[model samples]
Target chain A: MKRSKTMELGVGLFMLAGILGLVFLGLRVSGLSLSVPADTFTLQANFANIGGLKPRARVTMAGVNVGRVSAIELDTDWYDARVTLELDGALEGQLSRDTTAAILTAGLLGEQYVGLSPGGDPETLGDGDTLTDTQSALVLEELIQQFVSNMVRD
Target chain B: MIPRVIALGRHGCDLLEALGRSGLFLAQSALGWPSREGLYLWLRQMHFVGVLSLAIVLVSGLFIGMVLALQGYTILIDFGAEQALGQMVALSLLRELAPVVAALLFAGRAGSALTAEIGLMKATEQLTSMEMIGVDPLRRVVAPRLWAGFVSLPLLTVGFSVVGIYGGFLVGVEWLGLFEGSYWSNMQASVDFIADVGNGMLKSLVFALVVTWIAVFQGYDLIPTSEGISRATTRTVVYSSLAVLGLDFVLTAVMFGGLS
Candidate 1:
């Protein structure tokens, strides 16, 4: 049986539309971009606790996103959490050697992200430089526990 | 009491027999590549299943997304976290709602149609006639429909998710006065492509296989009467919906449960 040209055209259009939807989801929705900007650099920070800080979580300076947490692992030698931050290359040679990296929560019960505060050191940090002065994630439950214990003792 | 026990045993046997037959049917219809003519048949069936169902899927996706944003905003506003509405809506749609709901609609729309069409052909002795003419109705009829469903469903699911997310954006950003940049950026930050979107696609693929198999098998195995066709058609919708919901729990647990 011979089908009409219109039917074939409809199918072709439908398939194209579906593929376009998939591409939109990939690029626009999920942000699956293939190209990485050439100037991005990586920095490492070690923390006593990361407290739900995940890869791809934002790294901010003065409440503006400058990078993302790229990887996280436990350092066997130091017994602390090792975090890798992928920063925008545009900020290269700006961060001092003594910059403080702290894990901060967005809202009271919200996501955990890294907050970087610049230091007074004239020496600039480079790619893969480890931030020595770092503040660990604040655990609310631990704080409550300490408060209860101190109150009982008093 | 003994007669009732015997009846129960017979019903169990009947169910097992049907299950075995459908498994065999799936094996027969799903294997092997399509020849040139078979490709044309598949295309025609895709028209029936995919193209025809597009409007309903898109419309449902849009409304569902809008509703999700509205509901999530109401809840998140109490916490002063309404900015997370975009993330909530996108995650829920991509991870759960879009694929499952689209499949349920597909089962109701295309699955029921496939069952009825095949059942009517069987009732009219078309399948028997093909067999008498030395043509395997399984190859000529069933395979095309099965392949069409398998290919069409995943594409439709993607379309549903994309439309649904924008629907959320419309409700959350435009109507409700949420920040547009935060809406998109929060979604982009939280919803990982491989974890959330890929898992949803995987769920839809499995659903496509099960739903189409149930639709075709119920029709092919029907008792070849007007009442039988109607019963099979109803069964296709009921069974497909139940299977989709049930399998969703199992798939969610495996994919996102992080059991380890």
Candidate 2:
């Protein structure tokens, strides 16, 4: 009985260690940062489409992640997609009034990401301001469907 | 014509017997009540089954993860798609390897022991004496073992998955020289909580039920002989392992179907 109890204790500890290790690793990985620091004001970008845009998808400017897409929603009346972005405070000053938010494919058939083009507007877009001029993602399947229909029509 | 009819009748009889046995087993478990004594017995058994099987599961899980990473890296490298190694290892471990390996380990450790202990009790007339003495052996014996198995299997599965994933990370990052940050980042990005890890845990719970049920049922119905005990033990391992694999396929189909 004592032997069995000892064995049980050992196993329980082993399992606990494994579980805690996983939790630690998961937290560490999720906290990985190459983008600008977190202390930044959040911005909103309105797009017509955010196909494959998931929460936590990176917001890149010039191939560098400066922020992350925090939320996505649809405006019911206008039938437009609205994305909430969290921009690093340091980089916020660079985003001009003419900044265009384009939903772009990260790789061939990869997840969609928001790409920002810092426009030439001298005034910078503030925290609560929305970028009205946005480009939607190009859906490959829809493009193919259009192409096939055009071919058949021709 | 008569021989063919006889063969058809035999097949029907076999099917009916199997169905009846399954129905009786379910009825027994459903009708069984848990008293204080039964609860204590269950807790004790759980400590034995779950707590004792941890090390074996961890060691096996670690090796399995390492091997998967090594093999997956080699294959992906051949196609110059080595960047996807983390996702591959994480996906496979979560969806398939973790639960299956944990169930197989439980079958070998607890399942066999359950079979042998119950079979020995039957052979020694301990079970019969308990029944004669106005004790419900189902509640006292079978239920505890069954409950232990159901509780233990999932715990072991969680352990296996955690250790296994770490082992894979070690192999992929340290041994294979893959970028540690990118490997972990890809895994975190690609693996969804609902689709991969949650599905694996759900499958593990179901597999636990199947493993315990088969083990206890085989043991409880053992013939009154030493040879019977040996046979039951062997059959318990073989049958439980097969059931785990079969259930894995069915669960995979249902899970991926819903997700896709």
Candidate 3:
């Protein structure tokens, strides 16, 4: 019985170590979250394609992550993707009415993220307003198909 | 010529008989399943196979992860794409290494033990006695082991992948001096939910079934002798490992085809 108990304890410790290792790795890779004031507000960006966009996907402005995709919904009438993005509070003032939200891939076949191209418009987009002029995600498969077609034509 | 033909025919008949018996055994286990006794046995077997094997899985996973990162970094550096190491490590672990390695480990450890135990029981006529006593051997024995294998294999594979990714990160960032931010960013960007993790889980499930079925079947049908039991045990490990590898290749082909 004592031996069995010791074995059980050993096994338990091993499992705990594995779990802790995983958690530590996850935290390191994903980073720990600190609760901060909601300085950045969320707004919807309508797109014809979202590609492979998922929640927790980064929202970048000028190649820096300002926020993340908060949610995604499908537009009922047009069947377009409506992506909600949270912007950093500091950059909220900088986002003008003419800011173009384009779904961009980080690298070849990389994850889709929302890239905000801030425009020099005098009027700024108000909170909760949708960005009307949005560029959809570039589908790699479609691009390849088009490339093949062009090559054949040539 | 006629005598040689007769001998060949006899050998073929024996082979057919063995195949028929194996099929019968499979059907018997399947038909006898879903009982209360079977469920309890299955739970116990799962605990043994899954819960007991955690330590071995973790250790192997960590080492495998380290190796993957080191190898991937070395190769990528040559091409000026060292930054892609994290994504390569994560994708490989999630889709291929974790599930296959975990299943192989299971086959080496649990598969051998299971085969030996069942073989010994058969050799001692314990299974025959259970049958004589009107207890369904399939329910009392095989189903639990089968179910335990099915449940434990996938869970162990998940544990292996998670630990492996963590290990890779540790090696890549801490030892190799890769930027922490870039490592994770590449991993997050490259890995897809369906193609990587989901594929590994599916492969693991199939591996579990194959490993347990082959091991248990070999043991249960052992000849009534010590030497026979030993041979069966050895064969069980060899056959089960081969089956896992074969199944993995087929599954990978199907998954990649679907994705592409």
Candidate 4:
């Protein structure tokens, strides 16, 4: 009601807008969220080696991110890592039980993640079902070893 | 030996007395603050701190980011990891540079101004006249400026980070021809709102409190003379800067020490 109060409120609101804009941009830059949107479903895939494939790593198909690796655990019996993939709800119908997931690195020296290659199976994935076809992490040392062995054989 | 001991005792007593009085002054000002009158005065202080100080913050923040990108590129390129330029720049600015530099500048600009304005008011007997008429100068004069410091510093720090990030982007992506997509994506992937931004906001808020406290305390306790007022203004800037830097270390240790 008072002039000073009105001016004060206006300034407060202005500052608040600036702050909100800042938080929005900062979050976008940081890739963090206050509340994660709940339009996702979780699926499981196993890898012989996750090779630093951390939880919350991106899951991509055809180089497009459709999901994130929500959790990773080691199964002692198989000595493989079980990766839980939380994917966009829309992507649920697109994946099949026969989809072959591979742990792959981005760029030449970047973080590792799961890459899904589509399969020709009729059955779609569900909550508890796991993808049986998986490729483990490709270690550079092993590749070099194989390369040297090939040269020797030649 | 007796005289020396006595003098040391007197010095300690003086320090305690000053500390007690400053605490009382701050508490009274906060307690006696008039809400309606405070709103207007806060706006005035906010205008002085935020609008007037915007250019200095922007210029410094931009240069700081640009320098980061330029330097970060040199180091990251050695590993062929130039895409990480954004994350480096953003982390440094959001976590350290933006809050620390803006608070230092705010200490120089608005903190000194607040101290000078109040010190001059005291020197000119304006505060005395208000007191003589049964008005509390602490409520009318001091509280609003203090509250304004609390309000303005956070906004300025955030804006400073934004501008600084743009500066880094300009250098890393546009000037140096680094890939833009990776620059942005790597940054987003690394920076988290709760860890980086929220912690930064907390740091700035602490700095705001310390800087404003020093400014208002120095001005309110000014000796009511021209030289005294000027000296207090200088002390406001000096003490606020020192406190901000020192407290930043403690806060970082507490906030990020274990997390890292």
TM-score (0 to 1) of chain B for each candidate: 0.98, 0.92, 0.91, 0.95
- Listed per model, the TM-scores of chain A against the true chain A are 0.89, 0.77, 0.76, 0.80
Clashes of each: 1, 0, 0, 0
Native-to-model Cα distance after best TM-score fit, residue B90 in candidate 3, in Å: 1.3
Local error of candidate 1 at B90, Å? 0.6
lDDT tens readout by residue for model 3, A16-111: 654564454344433444465567888888999898888878898889888989899898988898889988877665688888999887666456
Deviation (Å) of B200 in candidate 4: 1.1
lDDT of 2 by residue, B63-82 (tens): 99899999999998876767
Fnat by candidate, in order = 0.58, 0.19, 0.06, 0.58
All candidates' TM-scores?
0.92, 0.76, 0.70, 0.86
For candidate 4, write residues A1-154 as lDDT tens digits.
Answer: 3355565665776588567757666667877667878688888887887777888888899889888998899888788788899988887777877999999987788888889899998889876678899998988988999999999999
lDDT (tens digit, per residue) of candidate 3 on B1-260? 99999999999999899779877887778564387656556555655776788879889999999999998888887776777878888888878898899999999889888888888888888889999999977778877787777777877777888778878889999999999888887876656665566676788888988888888888888886989988988898899888988888888888975745
Ranking by lDDT: 1, 4, 2, 3
- What's the residue-level lDDT of B99 in candidate 3? 83
Point out the worst 10-residue segment of candidate 4 chain A by lDDT. A1-10
Q: Largest lDDT belongs to which candidate?
A: 1
Stretches of candidate 4 off by over 4 Å are: A1-17, A23-27, A31-38, A74-80, A138-154, B1-17, B31-34
lDDT of 1 by residue, B1-260 (tens): 99999999999999999899999999988897788999889889989899999999999999999999999999999999998888899899989998899999999999999999999999999999999999889999999999989989998999899989999999999999999998998888788889998999999999999999999999999989999999999999999999999999999999999954
> Which candidate should be chosen as best, given TM-score against the real structure?
1
Q: Please list the C-alpha lDDT of all candidates, in the order they appear.
A: 0.93, 0.81, 0.80, 0.86
1 against 3, candidate with superior lDDT: 1
